[model samples]
Target: MRGPLVLACLTLLGAEASAQEVVKIGHVAPLSGPQASFGKDNENGARMAVEDLNAQGVTIGGKKIKLELVAEDDAADPKQGTAAAQKLCDAKVNGVVGHLNSGTTIPAAKIYNKCGVPQVTPSATNPELTQLGYKTVFRLLANDNALGAGLANHAAKQLKLKRIAIIDDRTAYGTGIAEVFKKTALANGVEIVDQQATNDKATDFMSILTAIKGKKPDGIFFGGMGPQAGPMLRQMQQLGLGKVYLFGGDGVCTAELPKLAANVKTIENVVCAVGGAALDKRAQGVEWKKRYDAKYPGQFQIYSAYAYDATMVLVDAMKRAKSTNPAVYAAKLFDTDYEGVSAHVQFEPNGELKNPAMTLYVYRGGVRVSTN
Candidate 1:
């Protein structure tokens, strides 16, 4: 009787183990480059979602589901981004949640689409990303269209600047935003005094600033990231352009901007636009940020909340579809109406966020403060 009872318990344990399914979600970002801070923050958000989902003991298709995050480092390179995407597809991850920059995300989107893997980008804002017509690609926030135009409108109407110089890193994101800002600023009767170009990895802007200084522009609009923006700010001060207003898109909008700028006084002159409402303004955002800070401390930059929402959005689709298979659940993303920490997650036919919000911010006393 004792031998029979022991055998029965063993058989039941084996059945329980077989009834559980493991789901892998891939997260790709520039985890080892100048943008690593932003990448880490993005990864942290997705990881937190995975942890929370597991804690809730989620089930799909009547089987217990264990979520796993498989992160990849694209180093902010387009080629590496494609490689990372292919690797995830080969690994057969159920979903994807990153490739933080537009340069990386655009190329990676093709690979994910080809493999039929659904990808949600939390931070990449290039309009062309969704324009590719890939059904598997989705954006979690407003695109460069909103961010660039918003900043241009503020510069021309709110700040009432007359002449502005433009500088872009020349990546897809940088160039796209810079062009929109230029066109909008010109239409608003603001003069584009000078136009210059730079690469994302460049650190020195002394020569460019020296040239633009001669133009006597009232402001400078830069389309790039915080790492380049920081050194450019210092160079601007060194070249006696400290009093000039500095306008930028979401690429330059980050909590680390002050630190990256080495606490420069020029930071106070910066006005940048981000693609979401101010996190501190909403009840849901406020609470979500509190939980994130407790878990991640000072690592918060700009896109963590969006990344968290993206991860949750993916899981919501899986749960609704009752399956973790990409082919089975990919279509469910287009129908997503999940309430997320960032916003009520919904998508247009082109995979762009529906009714997205944009916020402007500035640095005061070395801290990021929202202007809207």
Candidate 2:
């Protein structure tokens, strides 16, 4: 499902600003497939931030300013992602807020860097994205290295699962995190029974499970999107894969996973890891949900809050820099420290989170509960 999209109409509304230079923000992410909910959720959050900032008459250099979003669909494809970035560059947008998948975000990073458009990703976790020495690309979320190490440590020191099998979706983020998990797990004396590969769009997992079952692994580690993970969970359950846990990277943090797993029989015990804000129904999160529900009902997805924060951050930097020129605003971004829905957010010199933190989650009785 594509979910509810607050589609960006690309209209220019800078009348109140004395500067009269319209600032355009570009957003490109997956708006289709199993991860569609996530991309749409982020788009909604960005739209809210843009609307909020534009309504405030935010001024720069004695000129009122308007923040406008120009949205594009990456379709979770790297080529499409590069195309989207190029389109934004061609249009001369001020900045960007997306490229959700690391595989897509990584290649698109070079394009954004080449065009000098600062792009901050909300959810891509591959560490190599920032390791490329491209200052134009930033990741607000924690990287896969942290996530893989966290889960690996937990499995080895806490859960003490001796026999582990690792699997990857073959994407950049997937492979990177899985390799980290493998090395960490091995370092902790956990035996690597099997390692497998799967594609992001794969639905049939019987052969993989067949191979893994033969090895008698205590647990399975997957580094892929929730669409594939949910089905794999169902297959494992149906195949009588007992006492085996399913762990994955942030690629599995979709709201639709539970429902997807439920549709297939024999999927109950499943665990997942996520890399973004897990609002605990607090008043702040509740209020955000209420606003989102009022605007777009039953269409919530992961990383929306991050996307919102990213958009607001760019707008804030633009207002501070007092110019829509990409060069000036890009420089001013380094000077920003804003309190966003995600956290008091800022970036380090490497474009990673200043204090990178992650949260672990599990599906309990059909609801995602944060276990810290």
Candidate 3:
């Protein structure tokens, strides 16, 4: 009798285990390249959400659900980004959380849309992303319009700079923000002394800095990531342009930028904008950041909070829809009203975050200090 009862109990346990549904959330970023730190930080945020979700025990359609993160490395390349998107789609993930740069995210958005997977990008800020008109595409932060214009306004109105030079890495993200900055600065009566372009992989900026320095501009704006921005700062110092203010968009605003700048005094001249409020100022940001620091330690960068919110927003939609099917939950994203660590998550008709906030920061004593 004991043997029969034990066997029956084991069979019931197996059945119960089989009853739980496993849901995959796809995350794509440049995990192996120059921007790997940003990518890893983004992935860490999503992973944290997955851990928290599973710990809380998720149920959808009346069945216990287990969440899983399936991350891919896009190498910050557009081609690889699409490939990662297709790979995630083929894996039939219920949703996606990234493709950190606008250059990558723009292309990946189309593939995810075709695959019926909902994607919320925590870092890609180019305005063109949402203009693609895919309902499955959502941005968790302010777009480049806000970031570029904000920086340009500050340069023209706040700093009262008369002349500014622009250097862009020529990626979609860099070019987009640079164009907006140029336009806004010009409109505000600040002369665009010179405009230079380079590819994303280039590390040298001496020639361009020399040219811009010759122009005697009050400021230089770089539209690119920290990898390029950091070395650019050091090179600017080498070129004796340290005192000239260096302005940039979110891509250049990172915790790693100081280290990348190699302790250059020019780091003090860097004034960059990020798409959301400073974490220290948000209601939940301080506590959330403490937890993140304890878990990831020194891995925190600009977008983790947004990435965490993106993951939570996706899951919230899934729960509200009571289904993990992308077709069902993707629609629910349009109705998101959840409060996130970064900001309150709500979407405009175009899938842009509603009333998104932007914050400017400068380095003080080698640490990122919010200016506003």
- Writing each residue's lDDT as its tens digit, candidate 1 over 136-206 gives 99999999999999999999999999999999999999999999999999999999999999999999999
Q: Which candidate do you rate higher for lDDT, 2 or 3?
A: 3
Worst 10 residues of 2 by lDDT: 6-15
CA deviation > 4 Å runs, candidate 3: none
Candidate 3, residues 1-372, lDDT tens digits: the string is 569889999999999889999999999989987889999999999999999999999898899999999999999999999999999999999999997999999999999999899999999999999999999999999999999999999999999999999999989999999999999999999999999999888899989899899999989999998999999999999989978999999999998899999989999999999999899998799999999999999999889898899999998998999999999888999999999999999999899999999999999988999998
Q: Counting only residues 3 or more apart in sequence or on different chains, how many pairs clash (N, Cα, C under 3 Å) in candidate 1?
A: 0
True-structure RMSD, every candidate: 1.4, 7.1, 1.1
Query: What TM-score, computed on C-alpha atoms, does each candidate reach?
Result: 0.97, 0.92, 0.98
- Pairs clashing in candidate 3? none
- Among residues 3 or more apart in sequence or in different chains, the pairs in candidate 1 whose N, CA or C atoms overlap within 3 Å are none
Q: Give the worst 10-residue stretch by lDDT in candidate 1.
A: 256-265
Error of 3 at 349 (Å): 1.0
Task: Give candidate 2 misplaced runs (Cα > 4 Å).
Answer: 1-20, 263-268, 281-283
